[model samples]
Target chain A: MVDAGVNMALFAVVAVGYLALTIALGIYGYRKTLRNEDFMVGGRKINPVILALSYGATFLSTAAIIGFGGVSGQLGMGTIWLVALNILVGLIIAFIVFGKRTRRIGKRLNALTFPDFLGRAFNSPFIQVFSAAIILMGMPIYSAAVLLGGVNFVVASLDIDRNVALFGLAIIVTLYVTYGGIIAVMYNDALQGGIMFLGMLILLAVTYIELGGVVEAHQALTNLSPQVPQPLSDAGMRGWTAFPAFGSPLWYTFVTTFLLGVGIGALAQPQLAVRYMTAESGRSLNRALMVGGIFILVVVGTAYTVGPLSNVYFFNTYGETSMQYVGQNADMIIPVFVNEIFGGSLFGELFIVLFLLTLLCAAMSTLSSLLHTMGASAGYDIWRHVRANRSGSHTAEEVLHGHDKDLVRSMRAARIGTMVMIVVTVIVTYYMPANIIARSTAVFMGLTAAALLPAYTHVLFAKEPDTRAAKWSIVAGTVTWLFWGLFIQANNANQIGLRDALFPAATWPGVPYSVIDPLVIGLPVSTVVLLAFFLYGRRKGGL
Target chain B: MLGIDDPWIWTGHLFAIGLTLFCLIYGWLKFNDDGEDDING
Candidate 1:
């Protein structure tokens, strides 16, 4: 075993260095920020390259590195297909199909944030406020999930208390985001992303070296057992070279959870959407695609591959289930494996530093973006109503001036709101439920896809969106997802009850042989509502 | 078990590591140019 004292010292130096870099970036970003637009959208002058890296960095996060990587370890190397989908659907399709139009419309509308963009596009303050509220409520869970990633690594490497780690992370993240805002976030994202790329490369190299070779690793893994688990024992469990058998649960989870959820959901992501408005023009947006694609392929692709292959290493060393080595909590697998690999070697201390840096950057970049989005959305969408209500008390010129001040105040509120969000996330991290990343991402994107995807798709491709239909579609999708997430799916199986329970099985009826995720039910319902509304509007000469 | 043996697989991994490092360096240069433009602009 490695000396705990050396590990602690290495972890502290890395943590302090990361904190100092973030604070310096934040101070710089704050000084450069001269207006609300500059703070919120990086003055809409962000070059394609930084925008691309920031987007990929935010998108990858701890969710991609630790959560998905852990899942890949158990699910086998077939998960690489999801990485391909992330590049294709998440990056390419998002940029080419959705990004160009989003930038054009956003520029035309002078939209500074995602909710602001939506509100202007739809010509509805209600949509803006509604979307902003959704972000404020939903973002904490996602933030907490990211916090868990860093906290887990800290506990594994330095043996620090999880609560202490959580508090330290929350404070550092809040300080940078609260001061520097989006520019600091993006600048730091590019640097952290570079480190992440290098860290994964080192991990892949060492794992391959220790395992002897690719062929030997495969033969050892395959010959060991076919009876270990439902998914891992299958022929597909070897490495990144093969796909799982058709119709298997592993395949479904890959497609639904990682591929479809993250892949398609990236287009509608409020944080990423705001990036389009940050760039100068369509060309900058296009310029970003190559750099973004390669970064995603390297950082995400490496993490996913290392995740499953770690299984082979752990199994060989411990002579027991890899699960026994890392426990049922999949997030711990990567940290545990890293510690084991570099335990007593000179490389051990370096690995510890790199691992903590990777997680801290992952947490900071994702949290800053989420907080900024929340602040901007709340200020423009939610607070606008309060300003409008008090308008009757003021004269015409006074009202106009009040509106300007309200915009400023809303920006201030966003900063405060981010701090509030960080505290809530830290508290929640103390009492987290199981499958933190998968469940949280599922709920978040499921809600987003259900509520926003239908309307967003219409805005992008539909010739004429029936406003009435769009509103109803969003409402139906949003309500349906919320109902299932809160009521139908019990916190535990023992908590299942009548209205929440689906007859003939635990899931809602008519979605037989399925758990009836809201995306399954709400997405279809939203599409039907939108089409019906469009048809009705045309019939009434409203289109 | 489908027993398979090949010495080249070890070499393949070494090749992959080399290729990964090469790509990293290439990407760093390309991204660095763009980043400089962003900072200047």
Candidate 2:
């Protein structure tokens, strides 16, 4: 896009202007962080729009646009099913059912972090510690996923070297998050979400118009079925506009891994759940719901739409489908499409920079939220309990029930925890395999869902909230997921290399077990364990 | 109907729009309800 001097200068001016605005917001968030409460959840008084925007922005990162969007280009419109579930489950059910209760119960418990919320609710510090450990370990994979999406876009569009772009992006996110925590994260997310929403809507309309119209665009992509690559066709890819044939490996991966894994797994995400606690009241969350819904639709819906349809543009232009054109890295497709269509044209350079800004903001929003959650879990849930209890003045249990505890050092500890996690995340990002964004996201989300969802739901609704049921269910879910992920499912087994080292091949020769997501097996097992234990608890009159 | 003939694909698109519209109406209807009331507790 910056091939000419005039365009390069305009790009620089736009980049600088965007950076100035971001820095200003960062400073405002820093000044606003006068207390630990403000640092964690914005004093529990964040407005509805900001809450909605923050939630939406954090939910749909560059991973969604750059990673999944590229997959849509490669795979087709079947990914739209994910958008449907994202709205119904991720947005609607989340706000109306989970959010209201989380806000009310969070306020009642005086919980500052998600693990703290669980720990206080279940009256088990062990639950807090274990869940915190889970977040600390699993979140880096997702963080690396987001980090790579942003870096890849930078590498593709700006022609920057991969390592420099990776660390540079990481550093900018770190500066804002470490200083101001969730306040900085949410405020920046609001602006970022707004810009992304606008950009995507325009991109969607233009992409369709560029291809001829909505119907024309769809027809064009549908007609590319003959060119659907050989292995993919063998794996049941019908076309860009159709779902994979039922019972095929691609279908299992599509339905189980992407659609169900990401869709349902969104509920128990600590970063997203923590956002509900930021709102002042259920009414604010209620008002924020539709805004979040639309933001998701326009942002994710557009990405999914534009991605697969990019094939039509490429086919018409380059005489190859997107997969054939981009080679093995589906990650490069969207950025390449953006550049080819937008770069080197009159006034296209400015739009190109804005698109880059949208992606950077997305990476920042999601990364900051992940870092903050990890940091809070480490500092407040794990370390504070250990460190603060050394004095023996008050237990974390007593502190949750309204006993006052000094928290000044806890703030410093959280920032330090954030820094440590950032280093780990940067290392993970440095070595992450290519085209891993979507799969890694599904892995992390599925892990959280399996580990926390059943227990979390039980605590939300049960008056007495049986601790034994929750505790064992958490363990059962986690073990099942890990065993399947590491030993059976090629999706993770291939990445983690446990199954490969142990066995000759990644998966069994017999069936589709390799592609079936761990969530399918883990969640049901977790739920059964929870129900069994809860029934026993009730029979024992523990309720 | 939108040129993509697959029932699953079109239905998925319609479902997404339908859910978002439902959320929009729900938000408007419940905008001024009790801010702190909770049935769960």
Candidate 3:
């Protein structure tokens, strides 16, 4: 496909340049960081462009590209609706409807982290610790999912050994994140976001050209409609271009898990929400809304669009669907497409370098944000809170600023917690099965929405969300998500071990299992609990 | 146009891209015109 010597030389040069720039940014951020505020939220002065880029880059990782992109390739064009919803709901609603008050109150409350903000907003340390606990428990699985995408690409496209690539990426990201904290993450994310944007645009152009143009490509896809496997066609797949029949499993999977779960679920993401606290004023958020929207449209839209279109290109070139070409594992579709699509072309070697670097940038940018959030939760939210309690500090403000020791000790603890979580994430990556990246990502996102969204929305928009309701909402969300995931979602139920021995409950018997995701069940149940508690609190004059 | 035959494909893609541009332009104009100095202060 390519000349090994020339390609490796170009790749080496590009990789070195990319690494040098990322590390240099880490050093730059480290120098600029001084106080706890600077380390956690960049002293609340990040410009709009950087904040928007960083947020988008973190939001759309290799999981969106390789995992969901692969899912789009497997499932068809229905996933594009997720892109529409991402911009409209994920960015527009997130930045405009939620961002203004979040920044305003976050600043007024001096909230440095998401957990800190939750604790301060409702005046409850339990909320802070509990939210941190959820992040610490759930985020590593999501991070591992992101790592699988990057490592899979490295192994498949770059011809690197899987173990070496996995550990190597983990080590590099850990160093920079531990050194520079959130500031370093944001700086590197902005650069990575740029690469991802250009890379996706070039890839999309090349894909359309390779397919002999869009009309012919789609026509060819229509021609290949009968080639859809019997089970898929039976399950309601009409073709690559058309949506599945209503009330089908494919429809449920696409609508419930991918669309609703990732789209609506994005609002409650801790890492994404923390971005609101990093800006100087509401103006930064206002400016970011547009920048972030476009970035999402490009990065996420390219991934989902290119994913299904890969089927057209693959069938044209190899007489097989992308899924058939890559065995049963959909994760290999995008990497295989990149490897084969550019083969023997004049610029094949150059696109390969850009594509590989772009995937690395996407994965690292996201991993850094997740790990930073986890570290903050563990060190500041849990450790500092417990220490402050033991030392006779009752309020969150006291714990946040009671003694000089708070800042110094918590910073050290944060770095240590990050290192530990890095090791955990790498180990988890080894055990995660193929084709699980997108599903695992959806699980985390759905859990966040179920557990945090109702309470979080209440805190930002109204004054009625108090300590009691907040606690009940978190419990309701987490419990329902876990219960539905274990007893209902087929994939998750199988993992809980000895369902016969544990609960003696059969897997939910229906299309798309009992429910598509926890968001549907957990969200409604949590909302009901939230309102009930809010009313009870009002009656008792607790609000 | 790339001659994409499906109206849905092009229409959806164009709508998404158009909405993104609208957001960027609107945000830029609002930021510059809204007395950002006062907001920051």
Candidate 4:
């Protein structure tokens, strides 16, 4: 086995190499980036393949590999459905269905951000400011989750202090993003996505080999199902291979929160949506579909599939399931598995460093994108619009077609906004509970879906999406979602006043209430509101 | 009730693959029609 000293030396070498390469790319992007538009949208000339991989990398992240992987270790094979959903809805529909329309509209409007697109498309500054506010406010929670996922792995692998690791990671990510903007973020994302793909493939192979093979490992897991902890069995978990019992709490949680929530929610993710605007044309977007789909499959598919299989390995070696073996917090299961499988030998130590690099790739790629989006939303969309509004003579059109000098100021503000987001994310990361990455990711995605999906869908596909309809839809989605999250989901139910005021004895009652997520409630409400408004507007005087 | 024999899962996989193939073919045809003139920029 490689000693600690030697392992540290190897780690330092790989870490420094990765840092140097990413920084060099960032500098290269900075040099090429000319206008504010170029920084925000890569001059609308990003290579489709690069865009595909970058989008996939940013979408999956450590949340999939570590957070959701750990969930699958406990929840079992059903999670593969999520992988299938990610590819189908997240990649295929996203690139093929949404990408083409978004590109045409965004390019025509010269819309620089997702909020900017919405604002311009609907002719509603409210949509712009509100959507940007949602991103700025809600995205920090997701960013915190991503930061926590990356830092937790670092802490577990290197035996480092968690706070120090979090701070250090924030600084590194902030510097790259603030300086290089979207151009640098996407460039680095392509590199990170490559590393993530290779790492997942290797980890998948190593996991299956360690547990014998697929059939053997699965059979072993099935045989051990009776040993499933009482809490899980009570919640209707039959085994990892089988789906949870219909209408059970676990079933509700899995299908509602993890599956439908994230699956449908992905369509409206601001960061991912912005990617659609980056591609040059519908052809570029279409060309990206296959690459993006496969990347999602390779990264997400392997992580989730291997997650359930880890149970077999842990049961044989540690005489417990992967979740139990990792202790109570299931989020650490993937990291712990990495340590145990690849910890002892010299080659194992090398693999550990590579795995760390993979985690960094996943974390940094997503972090940079989310931070960039957050920055642009806050600075470029919200702050600038407010300023322009306050300046009495400036109409929205005049603000939109501002003088060239204003572009430089806006870009500077975006950098400052990026820095601010980093600071907020670090603070939030410090307080986050373990294993919240997947839940947090789902929450953010669902929130985006609720808040923006209906209006966004109408704008893209509708001939003339009614502005009143779009506004109502956003309100309905956000309200219903917030209500459910604050008072219905068991996780957040206890923290809200409604729990104490109405259901002190029973929080989040009913099958739907306890397990059915905001997406189910919020999305339909938003859609109905949109339809009602559209019909009303059409009947009244045409949209 | 579908148990491990759930057909929907398989259906999902096939559908996703189909969608991907469709995109690839459509993109190839569309770009081919857009032609070699503006391919680089």
lDDT against the true structure, each candidate: 0.66, 0.83, 0.77, 0.77
Question: In model 3 chain B, which range of ten residues has the least summed lDDT?
Answer: B32-41
| A179-242: candidate 4 lDDT, tens digit per residue | 5454455677778777778888888888878877756766777777787789999988988777
- Clashing residue pairs in candidate 2 are none
| Candidate of highest DockQ | 2
Q: Which docking class does model 3 fall in? A: acceptable
lDDT of 2 by residue, A4-45 (tens): 112556768999999788778867866676555544356356
Top model number, TM-score: 2
lDDT of 2 at A510: 38
From the highest DockQ down, the ranking of the candidates is 2, 3, 4, 1
| Error at A522, model 1, angstroms | 2.1
Report the candidate with higher lDDT, 1 versus 3: 3
Superior by lDDT: candidate 1 or candidate 2: 2
Worst 10 residues of 4 chain A by lDDT: A1-10
Top of the candidates by lDDT: 2
How do the residues A1-543 of candidate 1 rate in per-residue lDDT, one tens digit apiece?
222323666666777877788668766655666554545356356665666666566668887777777776666555565666676667666765677677777787778888777666677666776777777777777777888887877777776777787787777777767554444556777667767777777878888789887667666665555525645535234333344545554455455656566656666788888876665555555556657767777787787777767767877777654555676777777766777777777676776677677667777777777877776666556665656667655442232233566677777877776677777878877788545675576667667777888788777666665667778888888887677655544432223344444454544422222333556667788888888987888988953
Candidate 4 has what TM-score? 0.89
* Candidate 1 local Cα displacement, residue A473, angstroms: 1.1
Worst 10 residues of 1 chain A by lDDT: A507-516
Off by over 4 Å in 4: A1-6, A23-52, A180-188, A389-408, A495-508, B1-41
